[model samples]
Target: MQRSSTEGPSQYPHCLSSGRTQEAHLIRKGEDMENENKKSIKERVALRNSLVKEALAEFLGTFLLILFGVGSVAQTVLSRGSMGDPLTIHIGFTLAVTMAVYVAGGVSGAHINPAVSLAMCVLGRLSLCKFPVYAVCQFLGAFIGAAAVYGLYYDAFLDYTGGVLTVTGPNATAHIFSSYPGKHLSILNGFIDQVIGTGALLLCILAILDNKNKGAPKGIEPLMIGLIIMVIGVSMGLNCGYPVNPARDLGPRLFTAIAGWGTEVFSAGSHWWWIPVAGPLVGGMVGAVIYVLFIELHHVDPQKTPEEENSMKDKYEMIAMS
Candidate 1:
């Protein structure tokens, strides 16, 4: 989400706003306050943002993200020594993430990845009720996106692999959907790689979004995030394909399992599926907490406004008079 500088104004209002009600609720001697203050179910629901709408935005955004990101891998792998190289894959994902942010940022903060959603929930920036909703929507979107790629590349896939779907070596395409550790890596190395990669991802995102830093260059935070991802891929991706997102890996991996890759999808690389899921969650929290400890928590609070001071005095005087 820009919280953008260049993008004029966001198309939708933020579900979370900073304003608070300032009215006084003076008690009467005989008022039945508890009953009177009780809200109807519909009223309470109306007071909050619609979970349906937020989830829908997340789905559409994540759909676009995986459609481009995973589809690029399919293109690269299926091309087989011709086009769609590693650099192209990086560019594809960078654009994919940027566009996804644009799609969902207005309504749902464009948290196309579950790690981002989990971080927001931990920071109390997003409602706990909506965290699971966002994560589920993202996973579903990724699944559908992978299914689309399979359908689009079916002929090319069979041609490239000679009708066999192998996880490694000649004619292998499993890496198009999920991640695997490098040949020299152990299970622990792969896990640490994921943790560090995802941790870096979150750190970049938090820094870009924090105004206390150099204040992002307007509407380009999304662009910045995408580039951050590309940088991570270029630098840290060799260890395990940098599947910093769980849905990005698991969704497509699950699809491959159903589409013919079978149990091999899960059995490969010491059951590596869980690392992208669990590692990002832990790494994202680590990044957020680091930002708080180093930057946010240390910043001094601004002094109260004169209007606030006057209001406080007036409220106290009114209490004494009563």
Candidate 2:
């Protein structure tokens, strides 16, 4: 007897046909979910890796910067015959900051100081969440760098300088390494000088970093930044010690104060202590704001033909796929 098609084999057997189809569909869905999860995990891993790399860059940059700065001061103390010269300190820090920024720019944007980081944050270039981490890393790196300088010149510091770290008389050059005036000046004058000097330095930094204006050649960004620091040091070295960078000033100052300088660290008084920190911070913010207002905000988006836009999209997709 001929059996009906549906009755003989159940047309699509529940277990072997429809059931298998359902199972295959379920498998496909599971695979899609897994792929999405893996993509998310990879993105998170990349982000974390980038952050770690950046933080390390900041630490190393700050370390090198302080090493050069404090090392110069140590040299002055160690050299019995050679007096501490302001010009030497100026040149030393100028070279240090320039080298550090150039070396670390690709990794961490070369923000070796908190003042710069804060300015970037204000300008929306840096995230607020990362500022504290960067600041702490920089401070610790500076402390370690100062220790290295101390070790390098321990004998000289003890014998030639008699372990004294004063900011006056023969050691007046130490102020250039750190921040102090040869003689006490009016607090207001000192504060104003710091503010104006720091402001000018930050302004120069902002100008150099303005990718829109193309103020300098691509490879010359670090050189320009360094030159700006050098000019500030030379022009304002005698006034307020030109601590255009708060971290650069405060970190080494703390080292000097704790290494045995005592309340003499505050010799300029509490009011003066705030000048370096406050001046640079305010100046950086103002500089970034001014840049955003006058330069960055007005950047012209390059006119692109349809082909160019499509080409860009294709390139982006290719990058994503890879």
Candidate 3:
């Protein structure tokens, strides 16, 4: 979680090198083979603290988000206009965001949405090396969650469609997994809607996390974020079903294409599969740049980059150890 300044002139930190130093001292004295055993323990610990852990956390958090969100949609659609309504879905996604953040916030920043991950990377809040890892894990988690939802509602899915899965039939199932723009909206207009919706989502995210800008009272950000998702869902859903997150939409759409929904999942609404993926990434970056220009540009503070801090720590540690 933190880099210490006193690394003692070694590639590893003070704690890591202390054992090596002792081992080297003992080897000269021909004491024992105990130092060899110590080496493996250090390697194991280092591996545990690496990017793999963060990716797993991202995966689990995204899984929670997609599983429940898809489940809510299935419940609403399968009930044939009876069980759950639009509000039910809004609450489901709101809770999904809240619970997913709680699940991964401590470890991976809980960037279950790829849009959020991209925005953070753009803002220098996260390492670029970890971006692809987080994105892949998120997509995989979403895909698996959608698959699980399909399995959970297997009976209902078959009953509703008579075992024939079609995008625009009496038993349409694709919409439950991926979004489709309303009939009244043009493709270009739908794309614009996605841009605006995701842009707004990212803008609010930046505003809420800005400490200098009176960010959300700590511990309440996740809740407030959920409310934002709910509000966006209700307010901006008329045009394109409000897919503000790429992973939340594309991952499930891909799974549906592979699972049983056929290519119609992709071909639906004029090959509309790519909008959610491309729009959010572009919108997030725009939002980040806008926030920085409006707020960070005004504030004048000398701050060290994380890489700089880590490198400085290495030098200090080496000097101290020497």
Candidate 4:
């Protein structure tokens, strides 16, 4: 009938109960601390400023775009057309646009190109005040991206150029970073080429984003936008490599100007630097006009609710009668 002191739980019920209570208390305390830590982290990690977040997204997006594009050009030129080709550059740009959009679309609408941002501002989709911020971030991103490519291909560049950086020679590597008009290309024609290429770009972009019209599906807009770049490259790239994006061209061009190609990058092609910058800006406006006049304005308004349908019935009847 008597039990030993070391009989365990049966001999010391109260002590066992106390131990269990302590263990439960400690577990609950740990859980509470963990929950508090999680809450603190959740609150601290969120970015509250929309403009700053959007600018960062644009910067990253443009950086990726230029990185892949210029990297492809460097590969092709430095390899003596063995590793890649013009088609390879086109595909590189296409994938670059797609990847950049996927990265930045949710935050900043993925306007990796300043021309697109300018077009959005003109169309009232983006505010005028934010245009400069977006443009600055994009240009900075592209400049840094070009620098990265140059750093990556520094040895190849030296071998190809024999340490001589020229803008208009067989060893010219400046075109690897930016667009250059063909030998026979007139500055006027270069301007026209950019205008048409960028014009088509914005027109298709507007169509792709138009929900009222036959827009791209919810998740694949980025890829469609990419194909537009490829289309432009194949059709309009001959003259000036289809530098449809002002930031895309000028950012890398500025980088080349500073990174040993000298001011000749700006002064070459008959001082052709301004064409890519000004041409795309003008082309964006033109494309917006064309889309608004031809496609967006013609979109038929659809009623979303029963009340809306009823309200629009009378208007439809009147239009039908007219």
In terms of TM-score, the best-performing candidate is 4
Candidate 2: worst-modelled 10 consecutive residues by lDDT:
168-177
Each candidate structure's TM-score, on Cα atoms with residue i matched to residue i, is: 0.77, 0.72, 0.78, 0.89
Candidate 2 global TM-score: 0.72
Worst 10 contiguous positions by lDDT, candidate 4: 3-12
lDDT of 3: 0.86
What candidate 4 gets wrong by more than 4 Å, as runs, is 1-7, 13-21, 303-322
Candidate 2 wrong stretches, greater than 4 Å? 1-48, 77-84, 164-177, 182-184, 267-271, 301-322
Ordered from best to worst TM-score, the candidate numbers read 4, 3, 1, 2
Model 2, residue 306: distance off in Å is 18
> Candidate 2 residues 1-322, lDDT tens each?
9877667555547657877899999999999999999999988876567788898889899889989876776675567439566677767777888888887899999899888899889877899999998988887778778778877777766675666666566643345346664355676777777767767877788888776676888878887887887788778767666777777777777777787766566665543666777877887777777767877788888899999999999999999999
C-alpha lDDT (0 to 100) for residue 31 of candidate 3? 49
Q: Which model scores highest in lDDT?
A: 4
lDDT of 4 by residue, 166-276 (tens): 998678889998888888999888888888888999999999989998899999999999999999988888888988888898999999988899999988889999999
Model 4, 257: alpha-carbon shift in Å?
1.2
Better of 2 and 4 by TM-score: 4
